[model samples]
Target: MQNLDILTEDHYVLSAHIFEPRQNNRRILLINSATGVKQQIYFSFAQFFAEKGFTVITYDYRGIGLSKPNKMRGFPASMRIWGTKDYKALTSYIKTNFPGYHKFCLGHSVGALILGMNKDSEMFDEFIFVGTQNAFVGNLKLRTKIEAYLGFGIVQPLSTKLLGYFPASWFGLGESLPSGSAFDWRTLILNKKSTNKLLEKSDDFSRNLTQKVFVIRAEDDLWLTEKGVLSLLHNTYPDLKPTYRLIKTSESEKNEIGHINFFRSYNKKLWKIIFTRLEEGSHNVED
Candidate 1:
């Protein structure tokens, strides 16, 4: 694994790590992280893919994780910037450093959402979305929906207003998020139609994402529902239908494979499923 400091066109510096296999196969995989989640969370997964002979790269968006400013309270960052600038830079890095390789992406949650936000989806050979959803608060279960409203609707706004950032760490919610990203998420959750205007500005870039997409959902994930996942895919890629898989928990599996646990080493079965799908390079649906 090699650490890299990548600079975006906008001069924002992003921290990244690259895992290369002993024998290169001219195939590269990029792992886009979930919101407020560090790139390191995917390190073991990257190593697993690398052992399969595919080069892997993972990085944190600006103002998050290792790329965060020393004082994150007033740092400026937004979902748009994450898609347009941060991801664009990472894509460029891959194209320049690993030319002639078949590029694939594994996007988690907001990671998948940002892919639709960017105009460069054509650059990827395929996309694997894990626990990805539109995040409409109403789509959450009744209990989780109330939690979402309190956390994102009330706590986030109140915290950002008072501290200039959403200190998620204070509430054990992962990492603190920039005010811009927090506010943007709140707006999206509260007003669903806002995404339409955002998409219209993209000039149908999402539609241009013609490559095959594989969506994996965890049955026990409180944050996502099947309806929300389908809605997000339909809105983002109306022309092409993505292959979907819903993972069911088994008694043999000692650990719970929740939204975040899929990437952990304990979930070897799930990892094998993802690896097999990537190797097939086509939609192979399994219940």
Candidate 2:
């Protein structure tokens, strides 16, 4: 695994841990978690991708993980303090520095949202949304949903306001949801109006963005559902070909896995299937 060199370390202080294979030809950037989850969460995935001849780079989002935090602001402030700008800077760094590489991106949850927010087409050759769902509806159980909203939408914000940072136990959301992200997420659920406005500003980014989108969903995901995923795909540009598949249930469990544990499937069949698909050299978007 090759180490990442920090390029443009300024207010955003962009940084990444790069894993370049012995025979590097393709570049795949892992957009890290925004919920203060460690970049190490994706270390195994990085190693796996690097071994496949893809240059993999994973880094912490601003105010999360190894990257420095901006404590100058409080809760929601800290959450919105970076995100879009950091990704923009990171994309620029990769394009300018890493030439002669087929670029791809795999973003998780909010990481995927941020990619949509940036709407930069020239940044990569293809984009993969892993663990991404239509919207945040907690889980199958109503109680889980309530708990999430209370913990994330309500209690978490209150905690951030009082404590100056998001409480860690708040189910990975932390205190990042302010009016902006929260509102954006809400609009995503309610309709595509929010995404439309954001896209309108990007100056026909859809034309540049080949419809080839790969969305990976968990069979037992508590948040995003098949219905939501379909709705989201419907709102996306028609030219982009978006593919959705369930993370097959394990033979032993006879049930599916949760939103997170992408690696620890009932067995390895789920991931193996995904990796195999990635290995096939074609974008489903055109069809």
> Which of the numbered candidates is closest to the native, going by highest lDDT?
1
> Could you say which candidate leads in TM-score?
1
Candidate 2 C-alpha lDDT tens digits along 1-287: 55554543355454578887888655555554634456777778777767777777787665555664455244232222334566666677677777765677776766665555455545565667766644545322576567655555666556656665545545565434333344444444444353454444443344445646688887666776675566455654445568776665553154656665674433344555556666653343223
What lDDT does model 1 reach? 0.81
- For candidate 1, write residues 1-287 as lDDT tens digits: 99999999999899999999998877899999988899989999999989989999999998899989999778889877888889889998887888777889999988887776676667887899998887777767889889888888788899899999888788776778899888877765665643444455444467777777889998778788997888787876665558999888672175476788788777866788778877787333211
Model 2 deviation from native, Cα RMSD in Å:
4.3
- Candidate 1 lDDT at 196 equals 43
Which residue pairs overlap in candidate 1's backbone? none
Superposing every Cα of model 1 onto the true structure, what RMSD results? 3.0
